[model samples]
Target: MSFALKYRPSNFKDLLGQEVLVRVLHNAFNLKKIPESILLTGTSGVGKTTAARIISMCLNCTFGPTSDPCNTCQNCTSIKNFNHPDVIEIDAASNTSIEDVKVILENSRYMPISSKFKVYIIDEVHMLSNSAFNALLKVLEEPAPYVKFILATTEVKKIPVTIISRCQRFDFRRIPTDKLVNHLKVIAKKENVSFDEESIKLIAYNADGSIRNALSLLEQAAIYSNKTLSEKITKEMLGYVSRYTLLEIIEPLVIGNTVEAINKFEEACNSYNPIIILDNMLQIIYEICYFSITKKDPSIFNDNIITHVKNEKILSPTFLSRIWQVLFKGIQEVKSSSCIKQTANMLIIRLCYLSSLPSPKQIIDKIQGNTKTDNNRKALLELLKSNNMQDLYNQIYESDLEVTNYNNGTLNIKTNQVLPKDFHRNLLNFFYNLTNKTWNISIDQNFDISKSSNSCYNKSLDPTVCNILQEFDGAKVINIENIKKEQ
Candidate 1:
């Protein structure tokens, strides 16, 4: 019993985070502007109940608001034990009917039996139904001078605006990582518990903005490991997959290995939660982006992982963002899927194929370097006549589409930029034979270039291929003309 409640923060000064709220509340009390009712809104375990108790102690104590309560006084002792005659802690969830509320109200009119003010705390007040809320609204709207109401709720949305408006609301934010870690360290020392900083951070991350949740997870982890906390122990306790496995999954997607990537994902299915896998990928991408943009180590995030885990920071921000887009879509797909593994595998395949894609710069640069000149055009015309489809595909894929006119056994090639010799040969062969004409490839900044033949070509190659060729060349297609005079 002592262990369960031992670490509860005893006063506002003891509370970590929420400095503004604490300071405001203190000022309100000091100035005697304490409202007749107050709403404490936030997620559970961040000291709402404890704060309520502390306030009760402060208001009724013989010597008060000096950082320490006179716990020996009758009012302080009763409130401490939560059995004060003047202070009532009601579980609004369990007794939410109009009759229960009416009974409390009847008692409210009479005033405090012993303390300065009659205080009523309704926990999970949002759980009260509409009828119950209506019944309680009368007392909430207008209260006696000596009566005070305190309402706490996790789901503030469920509480009607009418109820919210009547109370002075204070929102408790999630405790920060450093604050929580230090608090945990202090508690552990007093309790003779053993743990490391990394293990504590893992617990904090799992808590997800709830200090109470953090403490609860710490208690559970500590018990499992006999008060000794380590990364391995915490991972096992929480059923979390290691960073290495996540990196392995990312490696295949980055390098364009669809089969191997999907296989690795299958191998880790039992060991990993798909949602968590997606979350890890997001964290990894953020780390990479941070490293790329800021030249900082992603490992020092200080919230989750501690030591720099890997050097996957080599990935660029744009690439990381693209990968994240694929992953974000994949996670959404897997969530509604009846067969999660199959959906995840399909998504992994899609992710791998993304790496094979060329950026706009690459395509534009290739086209610039591989324009067909007089010598190149003649060489390419020879390849065209010889009928080399493979060479044709390679050259077309590699080059920008500038050569617009192909007619009657001669290749007219045009470009303001020079073309690659190999590219010239490949395109010359493919176009001349396919059109039954010598290819005419021309280059001129003034001439409107033809639409990307490779882009149009790839539409037939990969189903997911989307041609964004216009972005690279800073030009648009005027026309595509292929003419063969009667041969």
Candidate 2:
């Protein structure tokens, strides 16, 4: 038997992860208040079907209707093998017609042949057609007391809400990596498979919380490595980048060496996935930031890499954020690009060059600091473009909009250009969601830019000019300069 089937949870007590589901079902069955219908939803291999089988065992155990069913009982054994006559299991993906549902409903009306309750376990219930759902809905609405339905699906959203409303729902959680690691350890010990801790962890990480996938990967690893699993063999089998190679690639990335980074990345590329390379880079960024904030090094990384991190001091939140955003974007590019190597190399070059570029705040500050040019408009334009609002960027840039004041989440602007309908409302909404703060944005048609600090009309600090402007009404200061020193 495969490891997945051999190690599958037989009872709620053995089920890993999903404490809430087990607790609720245990209480329900113990209280003799088991719902006539149940809906189990989660990603595959998180034990939705296993839970359904356990529920069957709970209902059919010869002792009584109990949460803890005896595995030795005939009914429990039959349900474990999915051959129980009273507990019928069908994959709705294959049998998804109204006629099929009608037959099941017809059978549901009859008393159990050998058990107290007749159970119908439908897997992938979302695949049922509208007509089939309608037919099943009518029966589920008024189920017979002797009948129980256990519906399992990965895509609960695809199922009708009405159907969901009729059943007790349990959303299963993915097994955490630590839990998966421990489970794999137990399985390996049982099979007498020699393995290392890192190898098991690599399997669990690659499994992405799917217990079945982890077991399958472990089983394959054991066979391919001659019943002995090492980190090297696991990396080769799973097409994962090695710890050494991961650090080697990240060193160049951190130091902003475009050529070396791309060279290291291409050299490491073999049967492994390019996406995993990006994921490794992201992991490095995460570790670096974690170290910078906590002053403690992660054990997974060697001292060599830690020395590299401290020497470069590249783990500042600003620089790390820059690398993180680019690599996160590169993962998708490699996934969609026709040539993974080319796209990845290009991404590496971008990352190396991107580190030297000024951040958005620095760029805005530099623009605003320039006294000769009218920079307020350019600063606002930069903000729009940086946020990827191309439409707003174009409108403001092309129309020659004048921004007079910007401070304390209030944007004061002077513009005569025609804007699209609901422009202010949409802009406010976007800024609010982005900043999580209410913003005051007002456009003026006839504002005096001459008195503003960020405006192009240069204002003076001369006492006479300041007094004249303050005393007079609607007075403008036009390019006052060469004032006396404060000494």
Candidate 3:
């Protein structure tokens, strides 16, 4: 038997990381107020089906309707061995037709031959067809007093609302990584296997909150290590890069050394899968981001990770976010591409290039200088000229304006002309896109253009001529010289 099945939780106390479900089940049994229909929903391998079986044992125990079941009791043994005549287990995925549900409903009507209650445990109940759900709804709406239905599904959304409303729903949460690791330790001791703490943690991390997956990985690692689990063996077995090697790869990236980064990546590719390497880098990036936000290192990672994170100077939250975006996009490309290694190499090059780019704050500081409003106006004009935004430039150049405020991301301009509806919006968007800063552009229209120095020319020149000059730079009308060939 697989380790997952062999170590399945047989009672509420044996279950891990599902306190709410256990509490509710214990209370229901204590009050003898168990619901006729119950729904268990969560991700795969989080023990929904196992909990259903345990509930069956508790309900049909010899002592009757108790929170705890006696393993030696005939009812408990029968249920555990899948031999109980009254306890039915169904896979809704394979039997999704209405006819299959009809059979269940017909059987539910009969009284239990021996047990105190007739229990039905349906796995993947969300796979039931629409008509099957309707049929099941009728049975759930008015179930027999002796009949109990425990429906388990990974996808609660697929179940019909009518059926969901008729049943008591319990959402099972994923087991925490620490809890999973500690549980694995106990299992390792019971199995008389030697394992390293880091190896156990790696297994738990790979399990992604699923106890069954953790156990399965543990079993595989034990077999591969000949009953002794070490970090090296586990890393090799899982095709994962070592933490030191991962740190080595990221060191070059953090330092913005493209050549060194690519060289380290090539070396890592020699021993590790591209996907695994990228995933580890992503994990490191996530940890760095967490550290930046919380000012505390993630506990699951080792001291080496903390030291590496502390040593890197470029891993601010914004810089780390940019790296994450690039890596995330690269992961998708690697997964879909025909040449994984080549694509990964390209991704590494891309990340190295991104590392050299200035962070959002740095760019903003460069654009909007450290001084005040006058500097900001000069910077804005320079940015417009560099980007060749002639229309906006002309508007700013021709307008009679004064800067009122420019600190803390707000750009206030006092202008005379009635600006276009999108003018303020466009200016704000332009500055935001350029510097990654949120600019609040407020236009003050109280200033009179008639009092300005060029007011006479502005009033005398035709609006069309002024517009043409503004739109076209250095435009001139040379005197027309009519040179004609001899006719």
Candidate 4:
């Protein structure tokens, strides 16, 4: 027998990490009011099926309906061995047709042959066909006093609501990591296996809150290390990156050293998968964000985590935010790329490049201090001319437009002309291309062009020619001599 089955809980006292279910079941047994039907739902390996089997044993025990079954009794031993005369175990996943359910329903009508109750245990009950469920519903709704039903499923949502409403439901929760580690410790002592504390913790963490999975990993780790588990063997077996190595990889990135970061990554690549490295980096980034906000390190992490926190204190929140975004985007890239090593290298280089760039606030401060804003209109014209936007420059220059303000990469203008629909979009694109930064161009309609000294209509010129020029900013009156000759 495997560690999971060999160590399965026999009574309510032995069940771990499911206090509420244990309490409810114990109370039901005490009152002799156990429900006719039950539904246990949870993720696999969290003890849903185990709980169901325990319930079956309790209901059919020869010592009466007790939460603590006497394992020595015939009924208890038979149920445990899955060879009881009255207790039936069904894998609903395989027997999903109506005919399969009919056989159980037909037998449920009879009295128990030797046990106190004729129990039926269905695993993965959600896999049953609709017709099969309908056939079983009649028997479940009104079962004989001697019959009991226990159903277990990983996906409760897939089960029909009608069947759910008819049964007493219990939701099984994931085992906590601390509880899992302690459980592994007890098992190690019993199995006479010596393991380091770090190895046990690593096994528990890798289990992802499943007790069965923890034991499975424990079994594998024990075999890998020849019954003496160490953190080094555990890391190599699981392809996990240690906290120290993760810190080393991130240090080069934080310092903006691309070559060193790539070299470190390549060195670690031999021992760990790239995805695992990125996952560890992501966790560190999260811890950094947490430390930056609350000024405290996460308790779950090691003391070396504090070293990272102290080193990253000099980083601005904005800089940390960019790092998180780039790393997050790279995760997806690495996962989908055919060549993981090349993809990981590119991701690291990208982070290094981004680390060297200035934050938004720093860029704003630099622009405010050094940007030439005294001649705002001339600056706008020069920017336009340098970008080969002469047509747009001439259009704006000849029109009744005034440069109200130009500062910190934003250009504010007051214009009377009805600009083209695409003017704003085109201008934004031009600014983005010229500065390699986004520039805001805002138009203020309230600024009266009539009051401007450069207003074309204000000049003492022919009224018709002025109106024509003002309306068409780029129009030229090359010759005024011949309206009649032109006609």
Candidate 5:
């Protein structure tokens, strides 16, 4: 038997991660207050059908309506084996019609052949058609005391509220990670299989909280590794991408190394699934941005991710956000495309291209740098004015000079007047003494000040003026262009 079927929970105590459902049902059965109809709802493989079967055994066991049922008893064994005349199991997905529901309603009226209660366990009950639901509703409203209904569905939204009102509802939760790992460990020990804990954790992580998925993955890994589940073999067998592999792929792409990124992706695709690769890439992007914003360590382990994230260049919100968007969109395209490899290669190219592109902040600053340049200009004037260099300060401040270049302590001044001899050299020395920063000062005597950088006087209007204009409908700021535009 497959591990899924072999390790299926047979009783309330055996069920994991659903304390409320188990406790409620256990109490009800022990007190003999079992509801006529029970509704179990949750995601698949979380023990809805299994719980339904266990309920049947609990009610019909020879020990009679107890919280715990003896598996050796004929009633419990028959129910477990799914061959009991009193216990009926139906796949509602296949039998979702009024006629099928009518047959069940008709059969439910008759007394049990041997057991005390007749149990009907319907799986995927939400798939029943509207007419079928309406038919089932009447029976649920007035179910016979000897007849019990246990309906299970992944989609509780599809169930009618009227039908839901009549049944006692229990929502089962997904099995937790620690519990799943322990469960898998117990199974491996029972089977006399040698396995590492990391291999079991990998299976659990990929299972997405589904116990059945975890067990099935373990089964595949065990067979592939010959009952010895090593982390390396399990990762290869499952085609799961690790954090380290993701770091390798992302580091190149973030650094704008298109060729290296593509080569790494090609290598990864040979081993891992394309979707898993995309998912891991997206996860890395998210983690980097998260750590950048929160200023927290990405992980406890000193793995490749920690070192890669410490690069600081790729930790920018601009890079991480852009790459995340490109990779996220690429995932959808790859899913639809017949040639995933080609599409994925294009995705890598697009990612590197985006990385090379300037950030909005960088572009805006390069264009104007208005706010930053004003600070430098103000500081230079303050130094010249306060240090008793009245003649030079007046010459500079009073002259019709145009700043052709002002970058990082370098200043090039052009004026429509003759400069004093050794003025540039003296100013450089004085500027260094004032700020302790070496400067490159150049001048073009007898030059027009018209061809110069932006005028500090022609400032843009308050940004909120536009906001105020937009806030009130039909509000207009007349001659808006003339207000902002200077020829």
Candidate 6:
């Protein structure tokens, strides 16, 4: 199979994304307005190297600046083969010291050996240290007429503003999924490979907008399927779980079913790898929030689940937003934790508890429904008015009881999820005594001590585990014996 680099487009016409940049470069080259120093900023595998080569070819083409590189010419062929004496490619990552910069500078004063203009292409320019940048500044500021410099880096911010001000900067964005997928389709067809639409989509999405990555993944999928391609093969090759599994785990969280939530998580963990499971869950939550706000079918979320989420209001723009806040923090936690499964399970349980907790809107609705006096409700009203709902929710979620929605009909309240039932009753009664009327009260579900069952907690069953599983009251492993009969 042709890997990404093997089918690498050599000309600007073959470039997938960054049309504006290409147009600008093409116009510049046509106008004979090539800059002495050019800076290309973008992520890796997004054709930075390819673009640099094309620019070099354009400048050195025997047909002239306004003409295309006639691939037949010695200059064009040598540049394409990366053996042109005038076209120098350096890895700044390995040669990042100031001495290396001086060596490059020592040669910058000389004219091209055989081509029209000598080109210096420095990949990963950000790897150059401060001294290295300073060493190269003078030569860049006043370059020889026969010299061209193309600096490419994934990070542009690290390059000193001094160096930045001296170059024509081209910001290459990540290749969009659609464009990448289209390119992938062309490659697949050319390679005599067959793949489903979903397979292409997954590869494109997983590539994260890098053409090189998309090609690499396609290659991996092809190998996994024994030189064939399909949606199932690609998914299995990547070990990526279905969106359904993420949705199933999330449903229990929406309804505050701790046991079922953990159980569903454990069941998914069995077949799918733990990291993949967490990533899929995190992605779904992100999509749920994004789609909820944009109100568009992105084709990633299942249609039926979207319908259900739309109907139940569980996935409201606001609620989904809050869920995202919780999940984002949880994702980081799971990623950093030594025990992946245990950390992820804890995150799931925490999400379920958070879902059961009163939403910001619920708090506002309760405050509005209770207190009669406008002046008394103003304090709680102001709290809601501020968009600091996340902060308040967390404060209320973690604090102790004695929270009163109204004291002497004044809406002064505190909240806690861990308050004892009797203490909670007394706290509510205290508020009622002050108001001389019933006040709305609520208590969220506590973290279930009896329901704790994470793989990390039960490490006797596995040796590679790091954390202790949540200690459940009565949990057992049932290993079924094989039935051997005379057969």
**Candidate 5: misplaced stretches above 4 Å?**
255-259, 286-304, 313-329, 349-487
Per residue, candidate 1 scores C-alpha lDDT tens digits across 1-487 of: 4433766666678777878768987787778787788899888877788877777777777675434566788888788777899889999889988888888889999968887888888999999888888878889888998888889889999999998999989898887777777777777777678887788888877777677788788888889999888877988898877766777777777888788778877778877777777677677767766777886765533533323344353266777788888788788988989988778778888888888887667888767655533345545545544665654544443443343443465545444322344555655566655777665654343332243343333232222232444344654433444566997
Candidate 3 local Cα displacement, residue 373, angstroms: 7.7
- Candidate 4 lDDT over 1-487, as tens digits, reads 7899899887778888999999999999999889999999998899987787788888888777898988889888887787998888899999999999999988887888997888888999999999999998899888899898999999999999989999999999999988999999999999999998888988998888899999999988888899999988998888888777877888788878899989999998988889989988888777777777787876453464745543553345677788888999999999999999899999999998887788889899868744444367777788788778976787566666667678778888776554555667878888788778998789875534334334433232234556877899897644322234554
Across residues 1-487, which tens digit of lDDT does each residue of candidate 6 receive? Answer: 3587689877788887989778988889888788999999999899999889988888888886643566678888898888999999999999999999999999988888897899999999999999999998999989999999999999999999999999999988899888888998988888778888888888999998899999999888877787678777888888888777778888888778899989999999999877778777777777666666787766542344465453255677777777778888888887889998888888888888887678788998878765443443454445434535443333333343233444543334443232333544554565466457876655443334344344212323232221222354444543323356987
- TM-score each candidate: 0.67, 0.70, 0.74, 0.69, 0.70, 0.74
Worst 10 residues of 2 by lDDT: 452-461
Model 3 clash pairs are none
RMSD of candidates 1 onward, in order = 12.8, 14.1, 11.4, 11.8, 11.6, 16.7
Misplaced by over 4 Å in model 4 are 247-267, 286-301, 304-306, 309-487
Q: Model 4 misses residue 267 by how many Å?
A: 4.6
| True lDDT of residue 255, candidate 3 | 71
- Local lDDT at 147 for model 4: 92
lDDT: which candidate is best? Answer: 3
What lDDT score is found at residue 392 in candidate 3? 73
Runs of candidate 6 with Cα error greater than 4 angstroms are 300-304, 308-313, 360-487
Tens digit of lDDT per residue, candidate 2, span 250-305?
76776778888788888877646777778877877777777777878654423435
Question: Which should have the higher lDDT, number 2 or number 3?
Answer: 3
Candidate 2 — which pairs collide? none
lDDT of 3 by residue, 327-425 (tens): 998899999999999999889888888877788888898657535556666766777889988767666666555566766677788755444556677
